[model samples]
Target: MRSDRDQVGRRIVLAEDGVLLREGLTGLLHRFGHQVVAAVGDTDALQQAVAEHGPDMVITDVRMPPGYTDEGLRAALSVRRVRPGLAVLVLSQYVEQTYAARLLESDGAGLGYLLKDRIGDIEEFAAAVRQVAAGATVVDPEVIRQLLRRRRESSPLERLSPREREVLALMAQGRSNSAIAEALAVSEAAVTKHIGNLFTKLDLPPADTDHRRVLAVLAYLRGG
Candidate 1:
């Protein structure tokens, strides 16, 4: 059994339009030893909360406030421009690849784009909270599925073999080497080989300081 308390309490600012879900998520965060400095119901208030609190991370809805189209996402992007490298986790009712692409345009680190209803496990959500706050990228699997369904007519990903592409998609989901192997029912060594191949194909050289695995996924999201 994995524990949800694998990290210290992270300061968070939540932006959700629904009253019930906003309250529910606040309580959920509290259960996992987190502090929600502010929970706003609109884009303007959300930006204000970020500016004032300077929270360690923000969990905001993709749609918020009067317009309720992409206000929350746009605001998140705006806030990131001001506070570069700020950890953000945007929750969405539907999977929108454009939103994913737009969010990852600047930096892929410390980011999360998850569906509202697909977040079924409390422990996993807590883990995602920790991962994003710690500068790791955690993308929802459905988003990856949608990306996979797209025809890679011409892109950097065209160089990758089908297996390498499979490995890359799992990486986008933030899966570990062992987890990827288990998911694919293959050996860890095989997963590593596929990862190396994809990285080479994407021209991402190995760097101890750089998250090449995430960069590969970002490449896929960008134009692959």
Candidate 2:
């Protein structure tokens, strides 16, 4: 696990409508050795800054000026479309599964979606930023837990054994098999077996790439 301080000097673009929160985040990033190349309060400004600065990562609120309903998320998607691999970390007051699904439905690399309350844990928040910038997926654990609870009654996930579900949750957290094994106090080979079973039960075909694992996790998140 990389600490917040281990990942420093990243160039960032921030977007938030609230002046105080935006300023506070800017200060925090600066303190953590990241450069806020641009800070904007609206979608258009955000788009412009991303184009101009091409920051290593973007951190934005889910709601922004003009209209507070998902403009920030939409803008983030647009930025991803224009700049394929640009890392994006979204902060929201609420967990909107639809927004999260849309974000993950893309390439699934260099993405993050976390709640605003998580900002209080400055170290965790900073680490998330670093993870996204490093082209890793970082979904909030709450988001995963909520999705699991909501879909438990009717989803294919109900077919999973308890241990398999545990494995799947850790997979959704973007943990590698070794990391998952360490977390679960199991052998790496056991983790691999569990992962294989998860994919088979989820009806995900094997692929040369590990993206099959990502797809399986997404299926679980989507309640299928």
Candidate 3:
């Protein structure tokens, strides 16, 4: 069960330029008990709405009105500068490694980077929102895969057997060794061996053992 602090719904302000997605997300979140304090289509209104509503969270896209380059990202950064604790969940239609890095660089609570395409899974998206609002990090599975793929291309993983690459992909998807084994119809011991081999070839640090998986992917994404 969630603690009282979490059970209470958060006030959310949304900024998505796509009319249908913006409204659809608003409705979904509202159904989940979160308050839709404001929903707008442009950066100016988004910023203004945030100021006026003082929402607990902000769901936005990477691009919005005006230049449409990265207006939403810029707006989120501005919000962070003024209200350091505000939760932000950014939705993007495509992978922008740089944009994801910028949000991660903030080092703030309630940070999220998810693709809008996944909005079809209402429960998953809602869970991400709640996770971020409660001060957890949530990166989209696709983004993680993209980041990992970029890294693997240059690394010695290029030498791994095709089967090993498949195992690594499942691991990159946040699956455990046991789960990967089950999915691949292999033994957990085999999965463990594959992971060790991959780690050794990649020369990733052993420190923060629990987080190194994501870190490894992030490093790859950053072209490390």
Runs of candidate 3 with Cα error greater than 4 angstroms are 152-224
Winner on lDDT between 1 and 3 is 1
The full ranking of all candidates by TM-score, starting with the best, is 3, 2, 1
The lDDT of each candidate is 0.86, 0.88, 0.84
lDDT for each residue of candidate 2 in 76-129, tens digit (9 for 90 to 100):
999988899999999989988878777888875999999999999999988888
**What would the per-residue lDDT of candidate 3 be over residues 1-224, giving only the tens digit for each residue?**
86676667899999988888888888898899999999999988988999999999989999888887888998998987888889999999899888887888896778999998888888888888888899999999889888777766756657667777787678678888899999999999998888777676667657676676776565444432
Residue 202 of candidate 2: its Cα lDDT? 83
lDDT of 1: 0.86
The C-alpha TM-scores of every prediction are 0.65, 0.67, 0.67
lDDT of model number 3: 0.84
Which lDDT value does model 1 have at 18?
Answer: 92
For model 1, name the residue pairs that clash.
none
Worst 10 residues of 1 by lDDT: 1-10
lDDT of 2: 0.88
Top lDDT: which candidate number? 2
Q: Candidate 2: which pairs clash?
A: none
